[model samples]
Target: MESGTSSPQPPQSDLLDVFPQKGLEPGDIVVLVLYFLFVLAVGLWSTVKTKRDTVKGYFLAGGDMVWWPGLFSVLMLAWIFLPIYIAGQVDMYAGAIFIQQSLHLDLYLAIVGLLAITAVYTVAGGLAAVIYTDALQTLIMLIGALTLMGYSFAAVGGMEGLKEKYFLALASNRSENSSCGLPREDAFHIFRDPLTSDLPWPGVLFGMSIPSLWYWCTDQVIVQRTLAAKNLSHAKGGALMAAYLKVLPLFIMVFPGMVSRILFPDQVACADPEICRKICSNPSGCSDIAYPKLVLELLPTGLRGLMMAVMVAALMSSLTSIFNSASTIFTMDLWNHLRPRASEKELMIVGRVFVLLLVLVSILWIPVIQASQGGQLFIYIQSISSYLQPPVAVVFIMGCFWKRTNEKGAFWGLISGLLLGLVRLVLDFIYVEPRCDQPDERPVLVKSIHYLYFSMILSTVTLITVSTVSWFTEPPSKEMVSHLTWFTRHDPVVQKEQAPPAAPLSLALSQNGMPEASSSSRVQFEMVQENMSKTHSCDMTPKQSKVVKAILWLCGIQDKGKEELPARPEPVIVSLEENPLVKTLLDVNLIFCVSCAIFIWGYFA
Candidate 1:
């Protein structure tokens, strides 16, 4: 890699011409190929080994996964919600795309291939495959990320050197007397000036917590991972371990990003719109390319491919969790609402199809992601989330904690808050940020107020709306609040009389409008229901062709045409009990974890 030159250059010289372009070597290609094959192997193994014949098996991994894998799986998906872990996973997908563009790889090919490979296992094996593959990805990501972090720190001569050099990384042609293309004055601080800094102290303390609460507590993606745990103990263990893992990204991603800016300030910190456009095809700024630029220019051939694999792992981990959760939400919530009598098999098919459709739609949104928030992907994500998520978060929080929060209040509050946020969102799109050093032309609400502050305002308004509506509306039924609110979670479930199990459609049709069950008919129905209760190794019809059977096996589906509906079992009591010793250990660890987190924030502040 060439050192940064301070020598003067022609004003019109293309940035592309200024720096020599590099592509993946043969060894890099080999490593990347091996990584892909390994991922597919893991996916295939999970698909065959894991049970996925029922909704619980497919969507929640049968609630059987142990703590260790669940820990890594949660780390892969949930890291983005926490402030300290925010920069790590966001960099993965965005960094991967930037790396492809940097290497002059075919962008469309890369996107399609990545999404297709992810969709294959995700659609076929469901959440079990996602969790299994995520555990593997977590390992690869740690290795590759730590490897780069080591190389990065060495290149920068350690933390002391980084602090000295990062501030010096400024674009040569940056306009005098302007902050454009310069490192932030509070770059090293967590708590910054409330009014002027990119991340304000008050907003970080108050506003950021709203979305974080929503993500950790209510978001389907994060909750689904915990739902796969075997017991409360395993769930606690996984969550605690994931919390510990959060400390790694500060070293792995944040420091390396700073190192990239220091090492290649000319490219990563380019201020000239024309120069950035020529380099990354985005004139906003090339800061988003920091990590990718580091991987390409700083690493050896094989290691370069390993980091590529890491990026791929990160991308797949994030995407699979999202795809699985979205599928679950759509199938169980929307589809079930529309078709109450839809069979489990039909739900399964619908969920898988939804994933496929999501992939296709996601591909179409790539351009918008690439261009948003001055080409900084993480900022775009947070800003958009602020615009939409705070309201939903408020509703969830209120519904859980406040017994008085009726359905009408929650609904109207959410609608009102979302409308306000949506207006801000539309205005933001219509009046995009101007290029650095250009005039500020956006509205006062858009330009003067920060997104995080806007989130705080949104949340307050939502709380007000919910409270006002609930005060005037009729109180909710006791049954509705029982065992549902946080205060009532420990209350006993109000059991209702068990309804007789419905007969399978095939059996019902065969009976031919028998209005009353004679003793003989009841006996036959009981026998059929008993038979349906047990699991069978193979449920497909012998008459089906070998080809069709093979496809069904691959998809983890039974031949529903010949299958009998299983009798619904009586609900069992869920024991929240844990081994006293394990509980003590976890409780101790939680205190330690929280302490460490607080120390880091204060030290950084």
Candidate 2:
């Protein structure tokens, strides 16, 4: 009789089995992170005061934002979020062909390079520099994405032909007697089961989209830009721009996968063993590798380098943003709160030191991430973020909008969400093993989505429930309520001058005795008033006379009013010639825009 029990299962591969043997060279690793550090340092150098005194200055560059740099922030978002995500899809497709080559090395190194560039500017020039750099990065990334799409479409003999080829391939695979064939409407249906399906419509709509809102809305990296806006209008405009950019992912990520289905059908076939054994025993291994393999195989040298640079730029923008925000939180919330009276110079010193320490910690942790295998990188990063995010989002939203939430509730809710999410993650990791053998069986991806949704739901419920219970059980102090009231109110008087003059005087007297009167103070005060009067007189003379004359003229006494206006000393008039170069640049910009519009319209039509 055949053995009731099959042969003992193969020993499980190490969870870190995906790490490439070479790893990053020590020099390369240092250079990459250091480059990012240098960029951040440039931004940090622009910060002249302690973070406490210049919280807005440090975080938002005093809100004197420009449109171009704002555009960069938008671009940085794409650069940071899309490439790895798209690359992951490509790799999955390639894995179907059993390809051994992975973009792990490229991705890991690019991340390091990005970190280096972003860190230097962020640390030195602060948000201003980061924004400017982000703007440039954004343009580069857009061009790259568009170029990729154009090239991919042309290469695949246009979208229609590619779709036809894909369905034909799918049709060939259907069972002979079962009458199973690719549906004309859903030719791209790779996986079919609903409940067990990983990328089902339900997952995308219910699982991913809601979580993304919490992420993009409340996540420090993204929201930091909004907080830095010059006004509500700018903030809202920037957010809308980001939303528009988000819709570009379908063109950039999904279409590429479909393109690969036609261009590299063999890659998918080789993913299974029978094809691997029959056609080529040495399978390429996975479909995820399809993207990089296509890049390496098809794209020319210059374009390849350009695309690679775009990817690196994206990674850098995100890494720098994360590093900066993390450092800001640690230095301000933890360090400064502990040492509230620290001097500006001393705090700046502490900030720099904190940045260094955080970089070291991130470097150490990044290796662990690099070594992780058998899942999409974007999904993995986002899933982890979701677990930590919901509680923070909940507390912040509640604290911002609700009056009853106390600090205790916020703290406990965050802790509870993190603990529960982590417990679920650990259980899933242990019990629901990563199905590395079956490329189509995306256990990690499905589990991650499940974990994120459940974690968010539980986190939201816990935060509201705990905050409500805590509010009633241990009510917030009157002082805390007053503070919350001050933050919420839009009244200028309440915001600018909450305490009366007497209160300030009393507090000042308690700290130090009133200063003795001095002759120098009197002289300085008089001089300041004289200068103010002169400036005010200069501004009002012409406008005041014009208004008076107009009123008198309406009453038929214009000549009499003009005579009374004491001969306003002939207003100093200075005329300056426009720079020829400035005019040339404007003309050139107009021409470029028109040309671009014409070209696009003609091509599309």
Q: What's the lDDT for candidate 1? A: 0.77
Name every residue pair that clashes in candidate 1.
none
- What C-alpha lDDT do the candidate models reach, one value each? 0.77, 0.49
Candidate 1 lDDT over residue span 42-79, tens digit each: 98888888889878889988879888888543322221
Best by TM-score: 1
Q: Compose the digit string of candidate 2's lDDT tens values, residues 278-353.
A: 3222232233434544444455545655555455556555555655565556667677899875433345546555
Model 2 residue runs over 4 Å out of place are: 1-56, 72-114, 167-194, 200-203, 265-287, 371-373, 436-449, 467-471, 474-605
Q: How well does candidate 1 match the true structure in TM-score terms? A: 0.89
User: Candidate 1: which stretches are off by over 4 Å?
Assistant: 1-20, 72-96, 503-543, 560-567
Indicate which candidate wins on lDDT: 1
